[model samples]
Target: MTTFTDLNLCPELITTLKDLGYKQPTPVQAQAIPLVLAGHDLIAEAQTGTGKTASFALPMIDRLSRTPVEGEYHEIRGLILTPTRELAAQVGEHTLEYGRLLGMRVISIFGGVRFDNQIRKMKRGADILVATPGRLLDMLVQKKLSLAHLEMLVFDEADRMLDLGFIGEIRQLLAYMPEQRQTLLFSATLNDSVEVLADKLLREPKRVAIAARNSASQQVKQSVYAVDNGDKADVLSFLIHGGNWRQTLVFTRTKKRADQLTAELLEEGISAVAIHGDRTQRERTAALAAFTAGEVRVLVATDVAARGLDIDALPQVVNYDLPNQPEAYVHRIGRTGRAGQQGRAISLVAPDERRFLQDISALIGKPLQLQPVPILENGKLIEGGKLPEKKRNQSGKTRKGGANTKAASKAAKRAPLQPEEPVAPDTPGKRPSLFGR
Candidate 1:
């Protein structure tokens, strides 16, 4: 029964939310927004579509405007650090759109863009500054901006930052903030390092967990297929060709694979595009725009595009390769089944990934129905674990996008790697039908 108006938010912010057509706050928003509006440091665990952005953004904008202080030039009042440039840009855009009604200045800072432009913009100072750790550090060292005036610090994807080895750099950035700033750490799930960050950065923080551990969004229905690596593309093509599916998001493990897969899909008359770290800011933005606009029927990407993707009614997410980490499985699939719509997540697993698949199923505490692999044109099982002789023959040196195998040329390289982990399924001992030709 709690609505944005009932949360004791400022009238202006309430108006903004209403104008944006968000009449009710999400669970995270309803609970955390009140505490945040009270200037309390918070740790909120919510999935991608849970409106966590407004949970923090509305309150931050209100506090900056309602509470008057000696704001200075070239000093940011709030800092939100995310793990990737795409996320940073997104948060910045959201802040700008929502905070504009309040006449606020919001700026996004991340690497892969010109320093001159960011530096020029930073001179005037900003109310909300969204950034990536690396670029923030670079700007800090260059004396482009100072954080001494910052009143709020948010780690949007703390666990991701840890996985990306930014703790050291985060430590460096933390040293520059005032000891008495409000902190908000939001992520899909918390690992040990994130716990450490909350313990160290927050002061008497209120912890709000909207999602349970190892649980993917309920909005998404997940399934898997145990097939040989050779048949992944064929299976994907079949799924698209056979079903009423309109938009599908496919995840690969590396940038190189993303590019190659996109080309492969195009060759098969399927419109596809790939996004990764190697892509320029413009390229990534264009690809995402095209996908959102339905110009691209399928999107092939690495983990870089997995997190912080805010697509609505995405419908389908194909784990062309399962993620090595179980948590990533949650985020990748979360792209679909968003905003309370039904969505499907499908994983293609090879024989070698059986144990890994089991691990993930165990972690989620449910059995992922295994779709039997359809018969390929050839009367074989489709190289479940090994690379197609064609892929190997095409590049005996191995595809640059495959999993890291340089360390062990002796392990008998398989067709790149299909990701996996060993966790129990939510449904107990449920044996799914394994499909094969």
Candidate 2:
């Protein structure tokens, strides 16, 4: 049987991995590390929690540990571009943790934080730079950081990065990088766009794709619950507090809904907070830390900001609102059942979400059996109660953008905004967050 020992990683990386309690390499990591170590460009289609960070990080560290350091500037040897700031921080941590034994200096750059601090850090140079496209581009434009020395360029979560509209920024960063450098792109699914990006960036790259569609990790058992809009919160509260679920990540469709739900959950005496693009970077970081440290029991978030985020031991994930895009369903549920641990995913589907549910089922290539929403005898949610399928708002009339007639204006004043993708079907693959979330 193959082991980390058999992978023949550098001793420095091996020591750090052992200290981090990694007994063996995951399939993606085992196959990927060797290829990366050989300075080969790669496109690894692996799920979020497959330890891909270490897969690429170990190789970067092995190659950079003995690099010819010049004066004080560490000369960035590797650049890892991630979509969200949270993911940027995560990949940065993994690089530092694994590369520390070899004296590799790791830096994480992302927007929302002040630029002066990042500029100051940039003056000293980073050995391994993990960044979100926005800040990296900002720094690049400011002439504070140069990619001249970058040896490895990685677009971690390539599809998510592109969906989030980081493609142009990625191209900008690429423009500055040495063309001869090795490139690596990793995502759960590889669509045509990712293939095109890889083709343009890599040099006859070795491909290692993992067919874990509708799956990030097998530990997450997925189920759906049909409910009315009014019962969604009641059902959620029951599952979290009633079911004794200490930690559950609930995904909402909008930032407003996230804030509203978090507030409601707190009123019910359940610890919860909302994380979204509207939040200051500090608030998002604090909320995530609180959740990680068990200070907060629930993290309610919007899909736009939470994709590609890695939360450890995530036992349960609840979709308070179904995502408009079917592909987002996989990303949301992928949060739970990670790294060989059992996890549960419960999605709440309203009458308006029927098509969304069906589309998700088709995307994953499996039918999702939806049960009824669990409610208390008084039409409330009871502890350990699993409700059978029930339709809410028999007519899912959301005041969508109908022609602006006088009667329409009157209806709009009274109707709530309809839930649907802001983008047209023609531009489906455009920016995932159009409003610059």
Candidate 3:
């Protein structure tokens, strides 16, 4: 029954929460806010939609509000590092929204945009800076900013940063900050590498674990359709249009697949857009906004582009292609079923991708409900459509009569891309998207 008001937050924050209709603190927020306010270097294992941004933002804002730094010149006091630009922008936007009345200045810095604008903002100095590692490092090297006055450092989504190869930059950034400052590390999972990073950065950190490590949100209803790889797009289009889905987020494996999927969806009369590393900042922002506003019904994204994307009330998430890494799958469906909301995640699994599905099931410790693909064929719903077998060409004829040929084909179907971690052997366990609108 603990509420935001009972958490000893500042009156401005309480009022703002009321205005924003956030009646009570989420589990992570309720537990983490007090620890942060107490000035503890903490490690919190929580996902994106658990109101985690507010958990740390509220306390940081409260402390900064109590003691406003005043001078013609401004020094950076708070720093938050995120893996993707989308997430950095989200954290920066939330900080400003919560701390706006307190006269706190916040800025988000990342690559893909012109540097002069960020440099101009840096000249003014931000009270709270949310940035990607590379751009922040660039600013540091150019002597455009200093962390000498930094009092708080937050590494939001630390595991994702490690996955994206920011460990060295993170270390370099940590070296510049004062060791005495409070550090808060938040991530969906605290794997061994994240633990090592926290050990080096935090000082006897108070640990707050909201869930078991590397598990998907319990609220998501996960299921998969066993279909042929060639039929994935047809199945995805059928589900969106046939099921009458609104505001679906689809995840694809590659940027090229994302772009192609978007085009395919559009051709099918679905309003879809693709967001990836190749998209300019403005395009990415516009695509996200359109999807959020329901102007676009579907948003197709790659694993990298989807990081730190906070879409509210997203009811469905589709995986057009299974991710190579099990952890990546966890983060993809995480886009929906957030903040205790009921959500559905569906994956299109080809015969070749069953092993990938097995890898995911092992990681999550549960088997996903498997159903045969239902297809619209010849003006009727067809269940378990048999895909056409390939004919023998030059390569197939070479091995056609070999005794081991059948076994070799089976082995090839079973072979999956190596996961970052060992694929758990197929055991009894819980079993276990898209480009554009």
For each candidate in turn, the TM-score is 0.85, 0.87, 0.86
lDDT of each: 0.75, 0.76, 0.79
Of 1 and 3, the candidate ranking higher by lDDT: 3
lDDT of 3 by residue, 85-194 (tens): 89999999999999877788899999989998899988878888999999999999898899998999999999888777777677678777887899999999888778
> In model 3, what lDDT does residue 98 have?
93
Give the best candidate by TM-score: 2
Ranking by TM-score: 2, 3, 1
Per-residue lDDT of candidate 2, residues 1-437 (tens digit):
67787887878777888888999998898899899888888999987677888888888788877665868878888899888888898888878888787888899999889999888877889889999888888888978888897888888888877777676676667778888888888887887777778778889899887656544356777867765665566557656654678888998887778888898788778999888888998999999899989998999988766876778889899988887777778888888877888898888777777888888888888788666443333433332323322423311112122222222223224334345552322122555432233
What root-mean-square deviation over C-alphas does model 3 reach?
A: 9.3
- State the displacement of the C-alpha of residue 385, model 3, in Å, after optimal TM-score superposition: 13
Per-residue lDDT over 1-437 for candidate 1, one digit per residue giving the tens place of the 0 to 100 score: 88888988888877887888986878888889889888899998888887888878888888888754455553578889998888888889998888877778899998888989888888778888999998999888887788988899889978777767677687789888899899998977887667777888889999899889768888886767655665566557656754646799998866666777788678768898988877888888899999999998998888865568778789999988777677788888878887788998888876666666777888788887455432232322221233444542221123233421222222233364344343212112322221110
Candidate 3 stretches with Cα past 4 Å from truth are 375-437
